[model samples]
Target: MADYEERVKLVKEQLRLAIYFAREFMDVLGKEKALEIIEKAWIKYGADNWKGRLQGVPPEDILKVMGEWFKAQEKVRSELKVVEATPERLSIEFTRCPQYDVCQEMGVPEICQKYCDSDYGAATLINPKLKMIRDKELAYGADLCNHCWVMEE
Candidate 1:
């Protein structure tokens, strides 16, 4: 298994490659079409990535489980803070995101939003009632990324 630094390097490399391919597609297919395809692909990627992980979790416990997952990742990949956590909602603030950093360094910060948008699909896949809301993002120049997960009424 790769160590933390190695894993981080790998993730950054993946982001760089994704940007490269996205730019290539933009050149060949046009910007709008390329972005549309990229968004759809990421949404499906998000859903498929979480396909079976949350299938067995009860609706009431979904937020709790998600909160724990975020907490566990606080120092591993990003600087995170659990702002609020309850049975119905989980809110977290990411002060640092490697994805955003890599994207910005590559001069294509907008790509980070594509990655961020994946959370919505991932949430819905995990549980139909789950919704992900993120108003602030580091990639868009916000100081932090705020992610809130809530159960639908």
Candidate 2:
């Protein structure tokens, strides 16, 4: 939908700004502080964003809802492979990431690590009964990013 496209654009813009700010911060403060600030900010944002997106959605259906969103995202932009999806589990492999795309475009590719780390906090907010595991990320020069979510007892 057009709305989703707009949302994608907005996310891209936000990422660009974040990378710019991180560069600026690194120049003034240092790499450690810059990474810290960006990671902290995005973690908080991810938690809040996923919390709001999952609001009113039941635990059993959270992955379903997210799966639809994820599928839509692949359609809109980004190269994503849906590895598996079920009520109890979901997995996706991302070969192309918008953040990585932005980083490459801006020549600040390392910023993707800070952005990718937000998924950890976001997963916590999604559901305490759910566990999210990501072993590799494109930002870290991995061939692909694998995200797996499982429902826990």
What stretches of model 2 exceed 4 Å from their correct place?
1-12
Query: What does candidate 2's lDDT look like per residue over 1-153, in tens digits?
Result: 444346556667887666777899989988888887888887788778877888898888988988877777767555677888787788999876766777777877767788788787667766777788999999998999999988897
Backbone clash count, each prediction separately: 0, 0
Best model number under TM-score: 1
Error of 1 at 79 (Å): 0.9
Pairs that clash in candidate 1: none
Clashes of 1: 0
Over 1-153, each residue of candidate 1 has an lDDT whose tens digit, in order, gives 454557657778877778999889988999879877887788888877665556777778878877777777765654778889888889999777777777777876667777787788877877788899988988777899999989998
TM for every model, in the order presented, reads: 0.84, 0.82
lDDT value, residue 48 of candidate 2 = 82
Candidates' lDDT values, in order?
A: 0.79, 0.79
